[model samples]
Target: MKTADPALQAMLRERNLRIIMPIASILAALGLWEFLVWYNDVPHYLIPAPSLIAKTLIQDWATLAQSAWFTVKLTLLSLSLAIAGGVLLGMLFALSRTVEISLFPFAVILQVTPVVAIAPLILIYVESTFWALLICAWIVAFFPILSNTAIGLRSADHNLRDMFRLYQATPWQRLRYLLIPSALPYFMAALKIAGGLALIGAVVAEFVAGTAGQNTGLASRILESSFRNEIPRMFAALFLVSVLGIIIFLTTSWLSRAVLGHWHESEIKREL
Candidate 1:
């Protein structure tokens, strides 16, 4: 029988290691935490063991699920709005340097300004809790996407642009063929960043809104649990938030790779 390629074996080993290492590390940390808590006879209220957290998560699944769905909806809505606004404005900025010069500073200001500070004012102006939360999340997520997409649109090959100009190409044609293509990688990169920020923004907005009522998001649930001295339930809600964050990251990363895998150096797999 032919011998297996050593390079292939090495690649397979590396892939397994990537999966195994994180799982191992997470288990090790949990074990150490559980052991410390057990040895010290720490009160569950202080920091419930992971086992208790798991049980609480299962027990409170119905309530937590509703909140999780609400949070997910807010995150997705905010991210969608951010993408639409970012791409449109980014395209416009690419078309007109003067517009970019005039408006980019405002975008920078929005980025520098804390959404937490802005959220309270937004709540006063926007009567609807949903819309206020959404706007807060959008503010947090919009800038990275706009900046990256604008940079990408401007970064198209100068030679190709000159050729397009020589060909008397219509502006739309140039944008479709050259600018959008050049911007995809950068947009994808920004998407991954924005996804996490969007989740954070949604949570923070929920926090600002506080535990107003039964039908609310995870942050509200966290507040509700804390006030009632349901520490385990609070930890459970917190775990869900962390899990959602990981999901957003993994989902966005997969999307980026899927979009760029064929040609982009960042996503394309190379031989060991």
Candidate 2:
């Protein structure tokens, strides 16, 4: 058998070390969690053991899974709409200083406004809870994308801008070539941020407005479990939500690397 080079072996060892630490950390935390519950003899209602949480999750898999699906659907839908709308608005802002100055204050207002505070009024005005939830999530998710993308669009090299103008590039061409590429990294970063915000918004809205249609989300289930003092089930749902958020964050982060890998400094760090 051919021996691996020392440098390659060292790199492999380092990679494995990096992977092991997080896994070790998680296991240690879970072990500590289990110990605390056992040590305190914590009541099941107060703090369910990890074993109980797993059992509850399995026992209620059907209902929990359905609710999980609903929450995922709402999150995905809201994120899609936010990305589409935010990118367009960001472009508008980047292209016209006056338009940006006029409209940005409202965006800021939307950003600063708490979804919990807004959900009730939105539910009152909007005939359907679904629409209201969508709006609320969009409100929370859109601003980062819009603001980051606007900054990115404006970040294109001034020389390139001058060249485009000299070439008599059409507005669309300028946007497609100069602005879009320049803005992509910022947009992806915004997307990563927005993914978590979208989930939070959906859950918060559901918590406030309750469920509308046949499909109630995990947030509703969480609230229900909390009210009834179903501690294990609550922990299970909360765990799933936490998992979902982590997955979104990691997935977006991966996508950002995949798309901007060739151009961005963040991705290039690995090369050095």
Candidate 3:
């Protein structure tokens, strides 16, 4: 049999380690935490063991699942809105200097202002709690996309731009062929950032809205558990939120790789 190439074997080992290391670390940490808690006879109410949190998650799955679904819906809806608004506004800004100058400060203001500070005011104004939460999440997720897209659109090579102009390319052709491609990498990066922000905003908005009932999200569950001093349940809800965020991140990363892996340096895999 032919010997395996050493470089390929090294690459495979590296890839395996990348996957193994994080999982090993997480398991080790949890084991240590469980041991210390059991050894010290720690109260579950103060810091429940990971196993107890997992048990709470299973026992409360029905209630927790519904709330998780609500949170997922809220996060996705707000992110969708943010993408639509941010892309359109970014394009307009890239195409018009006056528009950028006029509107960018307002975007900055929205980003700098804490969502919690304005969430109460938004709830007071918006008749529907869902809409209010959505607006808050949108505000949190919109700025990064807008800024990145605008910058990316403007980042196309001037030489390529001049060539397009020399060829008398139509506006649509220039946009479709040149501007969009240049902006895609930046936009993908922003998507990862905005995805997490959207979830955080939804949770924070729900915390402020404090809407209770069948339609409420994970944040409401966390708040209720906190109020009742059901620490394990609170931890369970938090664990779900963390998992949801990780899912969003992984999905966005996969999408970025799918879209850019063949051409973009950022996504292309290279042997170490």
Candidate closest to the true structure, highest lDDT: 3
Pairs with steric clashes in candidate 3: none
lDDT of 2 at 16: 99
TM-scores, all models, native as reference:
0.95, 0.94, 0.96
Better of 2 and 3 by TM-score: 3
Candidate 1: tens digits of C-alpha lDDT, residues 1-272: 99999888988999999999999999999999999989999899998999999999999999999999999999999999999999999989988999999999999999999999999999999988999999999999999999999999999999999999999999999989988989999999999999999999999988998987667999998999899999999999999999999999999999999899999999999864
How high is the lDDT of residue 151 in model 3?
100
Every candidate's lDDT: 0.95, 0.91, 0.96
Worst 10 residues of 1 by lDDT: 206-215
- Candidate 2 accuracy as lDDT: 0.91
- C-alpha lDDT of residue 96 in model 2: 93
lDDT of 2 by residue, 1-272 (tens): 99999989989998999999999998998889999999989999988988899999999999999999988989999999999999889988988999999999999999999989998999999997888888999899999999998999999999999999999999999988988898888898899999999999988999998755677889888888988989899999999999889999999999999999887986765644
The TM-score-based order of candidates, best leading, equals 3, 1, 2
Worst 10 residues of 2 by lDDT: 263-272
